[model samples]
Target: MKEFMTNNDYHDIGFNGPNYTWCNNKEGLARIWERLDRIWLNSKSIMDLSNAVVKHLPRISSDHCPILLQIENKKMHNNREIRFKNMWCSYEVAKGIIAKS
Candidate 1:
């Protein structure tokens, strides 16, 4: 996590979720529970985005649910459509071939 964050230059870091989301369905002596997932950020992100937070939501299925992220930033324009594209899969020589294909 640290390496990824540092390489990407992310800032704030935190974990938000149920303390124990996983549990074994068994009697007293045989039961086991654990918190398996979490969210993370870095120091620069926290300092730059003061209102960022990760909130734990209600459990729905299995033993765990999802978390809600609240990031306070400038609002987007009403007509804007957000499009995400992954740029890390390109091979230099094959870039044109991949793009055309």
Candidate 2:
């Protein structure tokens, strides 16, 4: 999983609320808690969605707490607007091609 994430440029977006996401309904020492759920973002998403937030909602019925991703800023930038066509891809080579053109 670490290798895959590294290869794919995936990063975990830390959450707010309860630290432990999973819990075994038990008393005292028998109880078990762990964080098994998470929200991951790719390099592009991390860069484009800078205002995104991950929230860990309260657990009601299930053992795992629900996660929510809220995008505070939908627009990429307020000062300037950049547009891309459907045929254009945002790759390294594509950047060079667009720059050259």
lDDT of each prediction vs. the true structure? Answer: 0.65, 0.88
Q: Which residue pairs show collisions in model 2? A: none
Worst ten in a row by lDDT for model 1: 82-91
lDDT of 2 by residue, 1-101 (tens): 99999998899988899998999988999999999999999989988898889999999999999989998866455676668775676566687778775
TM-score of each: 0.46, 0.69
Best by lDDT: 2
lDDT of 2 at 65: 94
Give the Å shift of residue 60 in candidate 1.
Answer: 2.0
